[model samples]
Target: MTDDVPAQSLMLPVLLRPVISDLEKTDVAAAQTLRAALVKVENVHPGFTHDLVLGLVKKADLSINMNEALLRLQGQVADTDSEYRLRRAEEPFQELNRRSSLLKKILSRIPDEITDRRAFLDTIKEIASAIKKLLDVVNEIAGYIPGSTGKQALEQRKRDFVRYSKKFSTTLKEYFREGQPSAVFASALYLIHQTNLMIVTIKNKCE
Candidate 1:
């Protein structure tokens, strides 16, 4: 049994080179193309929904760190009339901080379930709800901008921004739902479709 095992191990290399060299050459280019294609696929899919969630969390942090601090200081210096506004700002900051922490952790775990299209789509919807809440907080802030014209414009822009983001979020969700990138990844991948063109251009320059 020991002699048979040694003889079998020695024969392993005999069938490898001719088979491996041709296979490796073909696969290497394919792998490169797939890698490049994935980048294109990711970009065309637009701003990742996961990033938007993190972005809102960051925005919430800014509101807590900067705006809330300013409001508290302003309240201390103001007449009693403005105390309510300071309280309002402080309340939302606290609530948003809680929401943001939950969201940050949720975002961290997303890459694992991202391959499941249904879950990925659901996450898009969930993040959109969170975004809507963020925009609502912004709208509340806009109402207190201290001047008639500026406050009106701020409110207008807030509405427009919300509308724009909703459309973008929907488009990204649709792109993932269609599952085109996964299909493309499974196929050729096309990491660098212009590789030959680039090589030829480089050769011409050298010549």
Candidate 2:
């Protein structure tokens, strides 16, 4: 009904073609690079998995997000982005993204570090509950079958907890000694610490 519709419709396609072409090209290039980068899905920009997993854990209301975030933080270089995104050739965009990643890492830790350990403890509490339930089920349900896979998974989980707990202890010592960071930042930091500790404790028990 507008005067511009016919003209705009014709022009829109002309204008959009270049952009669509460019996007397709970018996707192809990125796909080629990623195909070469990962042997298994596990190697796909580990950070994406990490951010996703942390998000998932949080979504599930588990307390393990902080400890996982901390571990994810340790190796993350600012330059390399998640393998899934298209790599830009423009230096400014690349630099900006790299810097952005650093900020993201810092920001992500805030929730865990500032919040109280209650969330972290709750994660452990949940784990304890789940494990007890699993054991109960296994005890009640297992026939004469001898496969130890359930027990093995439990052991692996326990080992993971022990390793993370040691790291959490060291980090907590530094965290407390640093005098409470700003109030805005406090809750997140507390949360991170608590979550990390909870993850460690639960993982230890599961091991």
Candidate 3:
């Protein structure tokens, strides 16, 4: 749960292969179309996977906002439970938790697959921004609690970032060849190092 926690080694779902096979069997043309689109995107943007993750983050944000609105409406109509646990035990939190879990799973796939420098740096930037937004959403959700029940989770997010940032640093190192910072790859390397440092700083500042 903490930011410094090591990455979980998750196997790709067994159903994924069967599901894709079923899709190919059921609608070959649609499956081909999907494949073509993915290939095109991969050709154009090597970092397309990162973009996909960012899109998921946006979706999560929308879900959170809708949940907030619903809670507000519920509040206006009738005063609900006083305890945070009771509220968190509801549908909205469950949905948010699901989204968060999915987002993390997708993100965990990126480092191993994307090796290009430009794509890697771009992915790192997007991930940093997305994670910041996610933590903010966490805080907002916690605000619904009467006390500080949410503090641990928020702190854990910070520590998780620390671990993720270290992972980024390691992955970036793989693509970096010996060169002056004047070159594009070197410049990217410098920027990535800075970004990792910034993540460390942000994590340290979290209470």
Candidate 4:
């Protein structure tokens, strides 16, 4: 697989068909069982099977450094949020800190390796949910700005935030589909750091 391949375009069925065919040649029963499990997972969580397969392939290739990458992400989140207390009001800062803490907790749950599929899936979902909550807090902060000039500035920042969020999501998805765990974690950290900066910017404008 090449980097040029789009994440959504890399269908799990297409990628697994040939591999399953080969597996069936050696062990038909095993191949059938694997296919059935994948189908069940896909039914419950679309696109997850693709991520799982890509992750396994990358793990086999020794391309992922999960522990180190996660540590770096955790550090980045901490460093970015360290300034929140100084830059923001007490209430907003506390909310932001709470959200950041939740995110860090979720990040800590991801293991050094993808040993358990269900656990990894749960962690990923938690991470996604935490990120959305953080973004919503930032949006709430943005909504409080008054005056025409502040509103205009907030609008521009909101546009930038939305654009960057989309880019982050796309890049992260591509990293996952390509089985680049380090890249996935880095992209996630980047988004969180950018979010912190956005909150600071909005707070400044509000003041």
Q: How does model 3 fare in lDDT?
A: 0.39
User: Which sections of candidate 2 miss by over 4 Å?
Assistant: 1-29, 40-107, 111-146, 178-207
Candidate 4: tens digits of C-alpha lDDT, residues 80-197:
3333432556565567667766775565444443346567767677777887887677666655667778767766765765675576568656755786665554444445445555
The candidate that achieves the highest TM-score relative to the unseen native structure: 4
The regions of model 3 sitting more than 4 angstroms off are: 1-102, 105-113, 149-153, 156-207
Q: Which lDDT tens digits does candidate 1 get at residues 96-157?
A: 33333333233333444457878866765665565566555555444445657666555555
What's the TM-score of every candidate structure? 0.35, 0.27, 0.34, 0.51
Q: Which lDDT values do the candidates have, in the order given?
A: 0.37, 0.38, 0.39, 0.57
Q: lDDT for model 4, on a 0 to 1 scale?
A: 0.57
Candidate order by TM-score, decreasing, is: 4, 1, 3, 2
| Clashes (N, CA, C under 3 Å) per candidate | 6, 22, 5, 0
lDDT of 1 at 18: 27
Best by lDDT: 4
Off by over 4 Å in 1: 1-89, 93-112, 176-207
**In model 1, what are the clashing residue pairs, if there are any?**
33-190, 33-191, 34-189, 34-191, 36-191, 37-191
The digit string of per-residue lDDT tens for model 2 on 98-166 reads 433433345344445445666544544443443334334333322222357644544454454345444
lDDT of 3 by residue, 81-187 (tens): 12111224554454444434333433433433355557756766765665555455555555443434345544565565456555545545654664221222222
lDDT of 2 at 182: 39
Positional deviation of 36 in candidate 4, in angstroms? 60
Every model's Cα RMSD, please?
A: 25.7, 20.6, 17.6, 18.3
Off by over 4 Å in 4: 1-81, 86-93, 104-116
Superposition-based RMSD of candidate 4 using all C-alpha atoms, in angstroms = 18.3
